[model samples]
Target: MRVIAVWSIKGGVGKTTAAVNLAALAAREGARALLWDLDPQGGASFLLRVSPRRKASPRRLARRSVELRRMVRATDVPNLDLLPSDLTYRTLELELNARKSPSRRLAVKLTPLDGHYDWVVLDCAPSVTLVSEAVLHAADDLLVPVIPSALSLRTLEQTRRFIAQTRSKAVRVLPFLSMVDRRRRLHREGCERFAGGAEGFLRTIVPMSSIVERAAEARLPLFAVAPSSRATRAFASLWQEVREQSASPTD
Candidate 1:
């Protein structure tokens, strides 16, 4: 299976939203997709209407006491399943740091499910922690959501450096502009400044919209509720970019 991690060092960059929508679209396209909500906030789990319960301790997952297979749960969406998250996940870094080869632990656990899933999307927490380090090693593609701001660009730079330092050069980092305000001059300038050349940024931009925010209240992905909306169409385009990357991904 190809693993995609929807991640960003800064919070509120539409990270989980990207993960949920991408997974939903993957399932709609008949791919067997599994979304793991690794954030303690359980954003992806909540959107898919799955209860945030643990079948096993995440701390013991790397040690083999907690098997990744047992934690798998079905989502209401066809061809999509979920691995829920809980409050305990806030302390996930501690457990991962305690393990040997923690960076490889998540990838190792997912190896057995290679034949079972077409895609495994990790809805990661917003941080540069041990948990994210594990995902950095595990994921084939790291889909980063960057808001139109100088601070966001800083984090993206940090992410690039971290990946380089880890020598996980096989991981393809695809950064994109998200929650962009078209009326803002700064937003337009920021996108133009950082979204091309060697940065490997995507051209599709998701505008800041109320439809996206409503997904949280509707407890569904934007595609499921407003397929014809501009935001949904943006997600579809985003999915296309990722699908192409998955076929022949590279650093």
Candidate 2:
């Protein structure tokens, strides 16, 4: 599986939304895509109509592939499935750290699903904990959502540093500007500045839209709920860039 983690150090930057919609679009391409909700809040799981699961302790859960398989919940969308988050995942740092090769435990547990899925997307929690280290090791690419703001860039730099410090895998960091508001000079200028200098910054910019917020309420990806919306088109372009870059070498 081509593992991708949709992550950021800061919350409310549209990470979960990007994860859900990207996975949805991947499914629409006729690929088997599994969305693993690693966030304790279970926002991505909820968006996909998957219920929260009881905590699957990493120790036992890692050894038993059968039990691990049981945790996957199929979504209404075909070619798309989910591994819902658990409430106890809040203590993932403790659970994951106890294991051997701690940071790679998530990758080890997910190995059995390699042949079953064409893609595996992780919707991560917003924190720089042991869990974040595991995420860095598990994914082949880090798909980050960056809002167009001064603080947002700082958070991005922090995340980049963390990945550099702990990665066991050659995970590419793909950052994109999200929740962009063209009406505001701050948003426009920030996007322009990042695009001008950043090598991996995606060309597609997802604008702040009510339709995007409503995707959570409607329990669907932006593409499925409002295909005609400009935000949806932006996501489509983003996914295209993602697919092309996913097959290319990591920077």
Q: What is each predicted model's overall lDDT from 0 to 1?
A: 0.86, 0.85
Residue 155 displacement (Å), model 2: 0.8
In model 2, the runs with Cα more than 4 Å from the true position are 53-67
Residues 170-250 of candidate 1: C-alpha lDDT, one tens digit per residue: 899899999999799989887677665236788778889999988879988888788899999999999998998789836
Off-target runs (Cα >4 Å) in candidate 1 are: 194-198, 249-251
Clash tally for model 2: 0
**Across residues 1-251, which tens digit of lDDT does each residue of candidate 2 receive?**
79999999999999999999999999998999999988889888788888745545444554434455677888998999998876766766776776677777888878889899999999999888887888888899899999888898899999888877884678888899999998999998978777733656877888999998888889988877888999999899999988988999875
lDDT of 1: 0.86
Candidate 1, residue 134: lDDT: 84
Q: How much does candidate 1 score in TM-score? A: 0.94
Clashes by residue pair, model 2: none
lDDT of 2: 0.85
Residues forming the 10-long window of minimal summed lDDT in candidate 1: 52-61
Q: Which candidate is the best by TM-score?
A: 1
